[model samples]
Target chain A: MRRDVFQAIADPTRRAIIGLIAIQAMTPNALAEYFDTTRQAVSKHLQILTECEIVRQEQTGREIYYHFNPGKMKEVADFVEPFRQLWEKRFDQLDHVLRKIKTTKK
Target chain B: MRRDVFQAIADPTRRAIIGLIAIQAMTPNALAEYFDTTRQAVSKHLQILTECEIVRQEQTGREIYYHFNPGKMKEVADFVEPFRQLWEKRFDQLDHVLRKIKTTKK
Candidate 1:
């Protein structure tokens, strides 16, 4: 089953992992070293991120390098954009309505 | 403790709640009726969304109404914007480098 991008991003460790890899591509071990958790824990987080397509991994020789995948994140932005725009428009309409009410009140 | 916006958005039910309220404001019970779960369960989900500031509530007479809070969600967008831009720039740079490599090979 496919997971929603929001569900994929809900973990603090996953967000931190995204942040680390966003700065520069790094081998899984190198990324693991920065956190106090075991390498396996980091690997698990990376796996979820990869499954979500939020991060992509490339194997070069013997090492796997993880990098941020911005295109995938555009999926997230697209998901929320409509709602964001809707609320903005609603607020604008509310403002107009309020103004009208004020004018009529006076 | 402050929760990351990503962490706040990670649940499917929460995302669904966000979607429902994005369309129109509704009372907690009215929102609960749409789901198979108990009202208390829905209430719990709404509590989390409210805590994250992703949803806001207003009491009208005897009922509380829930509405989407767009301004709070801007925080999530802002959090991810830097990383998204960074990756796009990196990918553009990579494309340039790849073109140079192709020309050199030619």
Candidate 2:
């Protein structure tokens, strides 16, 4: 999958929005109250997040309730797994090299 | 750190460049040759990646070799940890809920 989800989360405001939804579902206006930005700006970010499927918005009575979509975030975690493994392997090698140097010093 | 590293990786070409360097270091011309874009375009992407510290380029003899900077990648991994943990927790909850439903059905 493309890294659009990760890119969608690159913005601090978007990340904050995710954090908010992760805790509880809220309407756009409710979310806007927590941020310094206007509701339209928050709505724009929320739209991008929704496009990326990071957040799902549902109509609850008259208001739209935005909540965290764990499924989309799972995609991000899966995408990062390979890179994470690569880093871990590199770190292991570095650790081995350091240990060898320490043994030589001893 | 901000998600600039994550945003830096949002581009497919940049991701491809990182994959190329991950295997072995290469010159800008050589890296550009693997892609469909111009050398200048590749250079621009490289500059952004450098700004995010995702890749490092160094002068070796007369050629500038672009290599995978594992250090910068470590930062990206660290940045994603909390998000990853949050997803894992959510998944665990989902799994738990599913198991409970299954048991109730049984």
Candidate 3:
């Protein structure tokens, strides 16, 4: 199944994991030290993130470095872009209406 | 209960509702006409959105106009802004590293 970007980011732990790995590529062991949780938990979240295509692994020798996938993140940015603009435009419209209402009242 | 911004946006219906209202304030009945689903289902989503503070209801005569709460949406926008930047930065680093690797190989 293709996991969606929204569900992948639903969990707080997963969100934290994304933040930790986004700044720099990290191995499971090194990544786990940031949180109070066990390495297994971090690994599990990584698996889910990988499935969603939000995080990807690169193998260097025996070590795996998980890095942020910018292309995958473009979808999320796309999801939010319209909503952001829509709200701003509506607010501007509302402002104009309010101003008209005030002028009419005056 | 304080509903979080994450779960509130997890549903496609909720996100659509947000988009609709973001462009302009809408009533539940008016909003329902946009979808094939029942008005009650749309109303339920409106309720959840109101609880999360993402949508606000305005009383105009007997009709309630549901408006997008831009302040509340700031949280969702905030959650995404950093990830976008981080991923871009990391991708640039990866590009640089890959170019170096190519040079070494040649």
Candidate 3 residue A104 C-alpha distance from true site, Å: 35
Error of 3 at A55 (Å): 0.2
Give iRMSD, candidate 2.
Answer: 7.6
Please provide, for model 3 over A2-38, each residue's C-alpha lDDT reduced to its tens digit, 9 standing for 90 to 100.
3777777777777877766765789999989978899
Which has the higher TM-score value, candidate number 1 or candidate number 3?
1
Q: What is the TM-score (0 to 1) of candidate 3? A: 0.72
TM-score of chain B of each: 0.73, 0.70, 0.78
**Taking the tens digit of each residue's C-alpha lDDT, what string does model 2 give over A1-106?**
4437767867878877876676578899999998898999999989898888888889979999997876676655554545554566775555454444334321
Clash list (residue pairs), candidate 2 = none
Instruction: Quote the lDDT for B76 in model 2.
Output: 51
Identify the candidate with maximal DockQ: 1
> Docking category for candidate 1?
acceptable
Q: What is the lDDT of candidate 3?
A: 0.75
The clash count of every prediction, one per candidate, is: 0, 0, 0
Task: State candidate 2's TM-score.
Answer: 0.76
User: Model 2, B2-102: lDDT tens per residue?
Assistant: 43776776777887787677667788889999889899999988888888877888999998888777566665555444455456666555545444433
Candidate closest to the true structure, highest TM-score: 2
All-Cα superposition RMSD per candidate:
9.5, 10.0, 9.6
Tens digits of lDDT, candidate 1, A1-106: 6465676667767777776676578888998888889989999888888888888989999999998786677766655555555445656555454444334321
Q: Give the candidate order by descending TM-score.
A: 2, 1, 3
